[model samples]
Target chain A: MVIATETFRPLVLAQAKARKLEPHLIVVKHPVGGLNAEELKERIDAAFEGLKVEMKG
Target chain B: MRIVNPTYGIAPQGEGSATAGPVDWMNDPIVLFSNNKPNAKELLLGVRDRLSSIRRVDNVDYIAKGSASQPAPPEMLNEVVRKYRIALLALGD
Candidate 1:
């Protein structure tokens, strides 16, 4: 199930609040193979950006 | 901690004493944090299959990037850890 970037934060927060669950962030690192390290880094950055926006807003 | 990767290993036990020997790391409720979007179905299925083979695991929670969805926020991450008692976390490829 794919959720929109803009809606992810609220959705997660809402879910947590409804369930009374606390949120935790876990960052995974895989052994490089298909994508280069730089590309992976970019992807991670993008994910973080989304998370950051959610936190700010 | 017995960390069994079912995708690459054999099933541990169906029931009884063997299952009670040690904790299965893979079956634990986990928050899968990844940088990029991943095939959730495939990953979830694989995890499910592995967990099903063993009677020890009662629940598994996988949090990953969905289609067109953004990664989880920091607060969300923090909340998950604090709320769910997340036992294990696996990084995707």
Candidate 2:
């Protein structure tokens, strides 16, 4: 599974498209870099949630 | 009247689809791959920490690119494919 922020989601899809793979992607918020640990916690939580959903389905 | 879409472009032609097999998250080895972006590893690590509740953390390993500006070597990717049952790649800003 690919974990990408919303801003970079299209890029992941585009690259996967070129590779002819329908990627299992987990989209989080944008700007994953430059964030403090507190700020990044949200993204981590979102990623974990996405993974659980994928794992379940 | 016709308006051109600036974001539109011809995409590369794909030869065929590449598919990954279903992963047994609890038992199968999973690689948390980072593109070497700042905090990308942290994000994946955080996920790993949380994932421990559902799966074995010992089977989950971290692999990262040497540099964010450079593409990952084919050997590195090959190694992941050879060793890991699943990969959770982080690609971000």
Candidate 3:
């Protein structure tokens, strides 16, 4: 599974398509690179939600 | 016609991605793979910390490449696949 920013979601999708993979992707908001721990929590929250969905499925 | 060996001298019994049966996500070993961008490690570690609430984080480990510019080499990826049932890869933009 890939945890990618929303801006890069298409990039992940494109790579998965090329590889013929049905990717498990968790799309977070953009600019995760420089966020502080506090700022990063939201992205982490979103990713966790995505993961739970995948796990349940 | 000419043939080229793309395995780079790796002993080729057969080369392909390994497939596993269904995963027990809660109990299986999971690896947090970091691309080593600025906050990639933090993000992945955060996810792992959350994972601890529902599962055992002791079986989870972190492995990182040296740089974000280069993809993780195949050897490292192979080792991770061999060692863990699930890998959560952090992608940085």
Which candidate number maximizes TM-score? 2
lDDT of 1 at B70: 60
> Which window of ten consecutive residues has the lowest lDDT sum in model 1 chain B?
B15-24
The TM-score measured for candidate 2 stands at 0.89
Query: Local error of candidate 1 at A15, Å?
Result: 29
For model 2, the DockQ equals 0.80
lDDT of 3 by residue, B1-93 (tens): 888878656435554444447899889999899998888888888888888898888999999987789989999989998999888999867
Model 1, B38-82: lDDT tens per residue? 433333334444545543445555555433356667776776666
DockQ of each: 0.05, 0.80, 0.53
Candidate no. 1 TM-score: 0.33
Poorly placed runs, candidate 3 (over 4 Å): B1-20
lDDT of model 2, residue A10: 87
lDDT of 2 by residue, A1-57 (tens): 999999998899898887888999999998899999999999999999999999997
**lDDT of each candidate versus the true structure:** 0.42, 0.92, 0.86
Of the pair 2 and 3, which is ahead by TM-score? Answer: 2
